[model samples]
Target: MAENSLEKDYLEEDTQHGRYLTFSLEEEVFGIEIKYVTEIIGMQSITKVPEVPPHIKGIINLRGKIIPVIDVRLQFGKEPVDYNDRTCIIVIDIDAVSVGLIVDNVEEVLNIDDEAISPPPSNKTGFENRFMKGIGKAGGKVQLLLDCERLLKSDEMEIVEELFEEK
Candidate 1:
């Protein structure tokens, strides 16, 4: 009776919020909400935008659309690595702008329970912590869930504008 109804409600909630797309940066796992993801493409040639920040790898033409690409490794303050077969570009849309994130490789979509997500550790050191929304635990490993909107805010893009203004 009441017990059965409660179980059904829990299952429904779980189904609604139980999916994430996991990817790797360096040796750590990270995830972004799947809903924002547009597509994943293999590495491609990028045209450098002069005077832009180093993290901004450059722009890529996708089906007649030019999208800026960011090397997540550089964004995270790691030494840049050469693009290899496993490298990929993950297209995502934030605030109506489509951008591509260059990642080492994408793992797979995971169903992580909402209850398993914990707030970012207060003591974490480095710039990486500022980009993390929370930490999700699954299969005994931690996935640093990113706050995409914060990570891709206009403040950082202002640097790009400044570069163009100087030219």
Candidate 2:
């Protein structure tokens, strides 16, 4: 039984090894490891929370489970735009905590090999690339691959985790 479980785990890892779920934010595109994604939902009514950061849009009741949603544009310091038909919420699980990322629109999944990935630029120009894990080259285009663990800082994660515990 243990051997079978091990084999299944290996197979799952192999299939998701280089798979990425791409999404667009304005003109730039970003990718997240497909393994972390739980589901992609359309824009829904969000209940605003007070005293939270501006980037945090608020929480949503997803089938009785309250999920905190964050605006990717606001999180990246970009100007906010009205949510439209194209808006999507990508629900992801990081470190056992689930959070929803509000993005402009979700693109198709792509398989980017390790050889096609390049490290992010140095953080010497006062530019922030902390959320980026690497840059993926796919089909003649560059995709900024996000490190979901780093998407929310430790402090922020704690706060989000608390929300999960509260309910």
Candidate 3:
């Protein structure tokens, strides 16, 4: 089935992972595999769209391309904070679709090997850690690895596509 092939490809991609682009959401640090990252852009003006999810802050026009912007903090059910100079949009490619994840600030990209990562705790239920790929350890610090595939559901992606089509 097509799903099987997609899963296989994702697994292979996981094997090729090494570097992670680290960023912050509040005081906690998080990292996403560098392979999926396209570019890092500073905070930009967003066109607000109605009836979208709370986390979907709206869409941005990035050099003529319209892409939905997700507030990582709000997506995690955290309190909304004012966007400041340090706020950034981490443009990432997932399944050939580009989505911008608005993060607090970006830290340096680090080479976090597979051995330095561990699975998230399984005892919990609900959305907490739902998008976590792993917990990474480096230099006495921890970074929650984000699974981009899990971060945005297909239905939500559909909503985004519809918005663009209407524009």
Candidate 4:
């Protein structure tokens, strides 16, 4: 039974590898590793927290668990827009931390092979490459691959950790 369980876990990980959950933030599209995604939900009433960055929208009580949400558009330095029916919150778990990413809308799960990914452009171009894992080209389109672990700065991560502890 233990061997079976291990095999199952390995198979699941193998299947999820190289797959990405694609979402949009305006005209630009982004992709995050599918393995980190927990769930996708419609916009919910967010209880705002204080003293944090503006990009950190707030927290939402998700079936009893409180998850901090970040507005991807604001985080990427884009103008804020009204949330419509198409807006979605993508819940993801990174390094045991669960958080929600508010995006314009989710596109689809794409299987992008490693060969289809390329390194992001140099930061000298005034582009923030730290938040990006790579650039994925597939299906005749390009998607900015996000580095989930680097999405939050170190100090912001402390705030998120504290929020989880307090709630």
Please provide TM-scores, in order, for all candidate models, with all chains considered together.
0.82, 0.94, 0.86, 0.92
Q: Mind giving the per-residue lDDT tens digits that candidate 2 earns over 81-138?
A: 9999999999999988789999999999999999999999889877799999999999
Candidate number with greatest TM-score: 2
Error of 1 at 93 (Å): 0.2
How far in Å is the alpha carbon of 163 misplaced in model 1? 10
If both were scored by lDDT, which would come out higher, candidate 2 or candidate 4? 4
lDDT per residue (tens digit) for residues 36-111 in model 4: 9999999999999999999999999999998999999999999999999999999999889999999999999999
TM-score, structure 4 vs. true: 0.92
| Candidate 2: worst-modelled 10 consecutive residues by lDDT | 158-167
Query: Model 1 over residues 3-114: C-alpha lDDT tens digits?
Result: 9999999888666365778899889999988877899999989999877778998889999877889998998888899999999999988776777899999998887887
Off by over 4 Å in 2: 1-8
lDDT (tens digit, per residue) of candidate 3 on 1-167:
99999999999877646889999888899999898999999999999899999999899999999889999898888999999999999999888778999999999788887899999878555546778999999867999998988888888888877876754
Which lDDT values do the candidates have, in the order given?
0.83, 0.93, 0.89, 0.95
Q: Clashes in candidate 3: how many?
A: 0
Model 3 misplacement above 4 A: 1-16, 124-127
Off by over 4 Å in 4: 1-9
**Residue pairs in collision within model 3:** none
| Candidate order, lDDT descending | 4, 2, 3, 1
Q: Is candidate 1 or candidate 4 better by TM-score?
A: 4
- Of 1 and 2, which scores higher on TM-score? 2
